[model samples]
Target chain A: MDELNREAESAPLIKFFTKLQPLAPAVIELCEAHTYRVKIKKNALLVCPEAVCSECLFFIIKGAVRGFILDDDKDITVWLTDENNLIGNFRNPGIPKMNYKEHMQALEDTELLVLPYDLIDQLYAKFPETNVIGRKLLAIHYHISQERSILSRIPSAEARYKQFKETHPLLHFRVPVKFLASYLGMRIETLSRLRKKSKQENNLIG
Target chain B: MDELNREAESAPLIKFFTKLQPLAPAVIELCEAHTYRVKIKKNALLVCPEAVCSECLFFIIKGAVRGFILDDDKDITVWLTDENNLIGNFRNPGIPKMNYKEHMQALEDTELLVLPYDLIDQLYAKFPETNVIGRKLLAIHYHISQERSILSRIPSAEARYKQFKETHPLLHFRVPVKFLASYLGMRIETLSRLRKKSKQENNLIG
Candidate 1:
C-alpha cells in the first residue's frame, strides 16, 4: 500500500483525534457497523433527562445537537455539539451508577455516527489507538466543563456571552437565543440585551 | 492458557473498567505489565502541572494521590485517586499540544502503578478486548467531568462539602482540610467551622 493512501484511509478517525494523539488503522477499524446511523428531526429528544443513556457518545456527522438539563419546565442548555463534534448525556452528578440526568436533542435534522458504550468498551479493551481516542475525547469534555466553570466565574454576563461566542462560534447559528441564554447561565432578557448591545457595537445591527 | 491464570491476569484491568465491559487478553497482558510499581515521599509532587504527562495513568495500587489545580498561590484539590482508582490529568482532560494547568501530588508517601500512554495505545490497537477497556476508561473520566459540573452547581459551599465526603470518604482522611475546602468551592474558614460544628453536634470533642 502507498503511504499517502494509507494516511488518507486513516485520516478521518485521526482528524478528530487532535488530542491524546493519532490512532492506528486497526483501532479505527475496530468500530463495528452496528452503531446505527439515524436521522433525528429538529428538537427531537435523543435521550430524556433522568433516563438511562445506553449510547451516550456519538459523532454529529451532519447536524447539531444540544445536551441540556431540565429545571421547572425550563431547559438549560449545557453543551452544544455541532457537525464533526460529539455529544451525549453520558455523565451524571451525585450518583454512584453510570446514568444520564440530562437530555440530548437535535437542533436540526441530524445525522450521527453512533458509538455505544458497550461496543466502545469492547474496542477499548482490544485496541490501543482506541485508548488514545478515549483520552482525546476526555480532553474535549474536560475543556467544555472548564469553560462552563470559567464562564461562571467571569462575573459579567456580557463578558460570559462574549467568551462563549469566541470559544464556541459553531453554536451561534444552531442554538436559538433562549437556549443560548440559558446555556450561558443568563436569563433570556439579559441575553437579549447583550445581543442588542453586541450587534450595535459591531455595526452588525442597529 | 489455564483459566485460573487468565482470570488472575484480567481482573486488575477489569477493576478500572466501570462500564458494560470485558477485556481481551492481549490488552490485559499489556496493561498488567505497563503498570509498574513506584513510590513517593509525603509532601512530594508526583505530577507537575503544565508538563506534558508522559505517564499513561497511575493506578493507586496503594497509598493516596491528590490531584489539584493551582490557582495563583493556592492549591485546590479537585480529585483524589486512591486504591483501585486509575488517574492522570491527560486522560481526564486530554493532552493535545500541551497547555495543561494542573498538578497531582502525594498527600502522603504514595505507591503507584504507572503506565505510559503510548504503551497502552499500542496494546489497545493490538488487543480487541482492550478497546472496550479504553472506552470504559473514557466513560469514567466523562463521569468525573460531569460530576464536577453538578457539584459546582450544588448552590452552596456547605452542600458541596457534604457531597464530596459522601462520594469520596477514602480521600477525606488523607487530604488536608484547606485543599478539600477549595475543591468544595468554600473558604478554609467555613470548612473549619463546619468541622467544629460537626464535632460539637455529636459531643465528641468532650
Candidate 2:
C-alpha cells in the first residue's frame, strides 16, 4: 500500500483508539506499525469452523462480518458485527484444552485492520494505556455475548424479535431474514410472520 | 476469622491463581489483602434481578450459583457456575450506558472470595502478571458465553439438552430440573421426558 493510502486506512482505528482514551502519539505510532489492513470479499471465510482458532484481532473499518456455527447440519448465526467494531476468536490461543468451533465470514466486502496476539502482548507490556482499551474492548464484546445468551433463552418469538430490534437497530435490517431467524432461534417463516404483523401494527399507528 | 482459618480459606484461590501463572509472593499477598470470603446460603440471592449490576466478582470456592432473568414473568436461567470459577457482572462497570439485568442466586450453600472492581483495577496497575490471569479468566467466560449463545440457537431441544449434559456433567444432577430446562431453553416437561428417555437408552446400552 502507498504511504498516504496506508495513513488513510489507519485513520478509523486511530479515531477509535482516541475515543477510548487519549494516548501518546508514540503509542499510536507503535500500533500503526504493528497493524495491517485487509479487505475480505462477501461470503469469504475469515475463520473456518474446521481450522484452528484465529490468532489475530480484527478491527472492522468498513462493511460487516458474522460468526455462526453449524448445528445439526444447519447454519445458526451467533454473532454479527459491522464497521467500527472488533472481531476475531473469543478464545485465548494460549489457553490449553479449549476448542473454538465457530466460523467467521464476511457479510459484505469488508475492510479490517489486523493486530496479531503477539503485538497485543507487546502493547500491553510497552504501554500502560493499552490495557484500558483492551479491557474496554473485552467488556464491550463480553456484554454483547451475555446479551445474546439471554436473548436466546427468551420464550416468545415476537418478544425475541422485538428485543433484537431494540438492541440491534441496524443489524435487523442489514443481514438476511434467514440469518436473523437463526440468530433469534426461530424459523424464517416465524420471523416473516412477525415482521408482517409488526408492519401492519405500524401501518395502523401511522 | 482466625489467621489459620483465613489461610485455609485463601488456599483455594491461591492455587487457582498459581495454576494460571506463577506470581511473586508480594503479588499474591496484594490479592489476598484485597479479597474477602463470604458464604451464601442455598436459594439466597447474590445479585438480585431488581438490584444494580453486581460490582464484585465472586470466586466460588464451594457450592453453586445460577444467573437468571425474568422473561414474560418467568425465571429464565442464563448462567450457571460452581466451585473454582468466577462470577459477576459480565459488563465492565466502567463502561457507561450498559444495563445488567441478570439475577445471581446460590443454588446451594456457596463459599466465595469477593474481589471488588476498584481493587481489580489497582491490581492491574500494581502487578504485570495480573494481566495474564485476567485475560485467561475473561477468555474462559467469553468462551462460555459464546457457547451458551450457540446452544440457545440450536433448533433441536434434545441436542441442546445432550450438549448441556456433556458440558456440565455434574451440574445436571445438582440443579433442579426446572432451572435446567429453562437454561436449555425448553419446557420443564420436555426436559423431564428427555431425561427419562436418555436413562432408558443408557440402560439398554449398559
Candidate 3:
C-alpha cells in the first residue's frame, strides 16, 4: 500500500514535467534520474532564516507550503505553494549562497520531488535545452512577482484583496485565514470582514 | 569617428558575454549573431504600460534607464538600470503578450544590444547550451527581485535608503534624486533630509 501511494503521488510530477512540451528527451531523463522523492510532516520547516538556502528545488506532489518572515513579533506570509508548484531559492545558482529571507514550512503532510542544485548545474553542462526550460519557468515566475509588486503599489487595500483573489482563487481554500491575511498585508479583522461581506454578496447573487 | 565610437561601446557587451564562464562557445556565437545595437535618446520610453512588451532583451552598453509607474498622478520609480545591466520584460518568451506593469525610459542617451525573444528560442533549439546561460541569467535576476521584495517590507524609509545605497552605490550618482526618492517609497523632502543627515554623519566619522 505504501509503495502504491508513492507511485500515485509521483505520477503528477511526471505529468508536470511532460507538460513542459519543449524540454528535450535528455533533459527529461536528467530530471527523472536526479530528482529524489521526500515526505515532509505537517508544520515541518523546509527552509529557515539566517542560513544559506539548501541547494535544492522542490516540486510538490501533494500538500501545501507557506513562506513567511518573522518581522517584529509578526509573521508575515510572503507566498504559498501547493501541488504542481515548484519551490526553491531560484536566486543564487552559483555558490548556493542565499540568506534565507523567508521561512518555508509544510502546511500539511507533503510529498515532494527534491532536485539538487548540482544536478541542475550538471544538466546545464550536459543538456543545454534544460536552460531553455529554466528560462521559460523563471520568466513566468518573474512575471507573477512583477504583477504582485505592481498590485501592492495600489493605494486601496480592497482593490489589492480583489486582485489577489482573482489571481489566486484556490489559495483562499487551502491556506489558513491568518496566513492568508498576512500574505495580503491586512489585519485579521479586515480579512474577516471582507470574507463575510464577499460571502453575503455571493449568496445574494446566487 | 562614429564607427570607432560604436566599436568601443560594443566592446563592453562582448566582454560581458565572454565572462559567462559556463556558456559554450556556440552559445556565445548565438548571442553575437542575434544581438542588435540600438541607441535611444534621453527620456525616450523603452517600455510603456498596458502594451505588450517587445519580444527583446536589452544589454546596456552605456547610460541609464528607469522603470516606473504612474499612481494617482505621481510617478513611482520601480527600478533603475545602468551600464553592464540586462533589461527586458523577461516575463514572456512566446507570443510576447506581456502587459507592461511599469514604464521603462532611458534616463540618458543609451546604447543597448537588443536580442529578440525569437532568437533565444532558436538558440534553445539549436545550441542547447544557450539554455544554461539563459537559466543562470534568469536565476540571477530572480534573486535580485526577491531581495528587493524583502527590503521593501522593512518599515523604515531610512533603513530602506541605507540598504539601497549599500546594494546600489553607483546608482546614487546616476539616478535623479526625485526618481530615487520615489523608488525608495519616500517623499522628496524626506529623502533630502535623510541625505543631509547621512552626509553630516559621514563627515563627522571622516
Candidate closest to the true structure, highest TM-score: 2
Candidate 3's C-alpha runs over 4 A off are A1-9, A22-34, A47-54, A70-75, A91-100, A186-206, B1-9, B22-34, B47-54, B70-75, B91-100, B187-193
Whichever of 1 and 2 has more DockQ, that candidate is 2
Provide the lowest-lDDT 10-residue window in model 1 chain A.
A91-100
Clashes of 1: 29
| Residue ranges of candidate 1 with Cα displaced over 4 Å | A1-44, A48-58, A61-63, A70-77, A89-100, A106-163, A172-206, B1-34, B48-54, B70-77, B91-99, B125-128, B190-206
lDDT of 2 by residue, B111-197 (tens): 888777767778788785576677666776777778788888889999889888887889879998888898988988999999999
- Give the per-residue lDDT of model 1 (tens digit) for A35-103: 445577998987522233355467666888877765444455766667766676553322353123677
RMSD of each: 7.9, 3.5, 4.7
DockQ of each: 0.16, 0.48, 0.38
> TM-score rank, highest first?
2, 3, 1
Report iRMS values in order: 5.1, 3.1, 3.6
Better by lDDT, candidate 2 or 1: 2
User: Which candidate wins on DockQ?
Assistant: 2
Sort by lDDT, best first: what order? 2, 3, 1
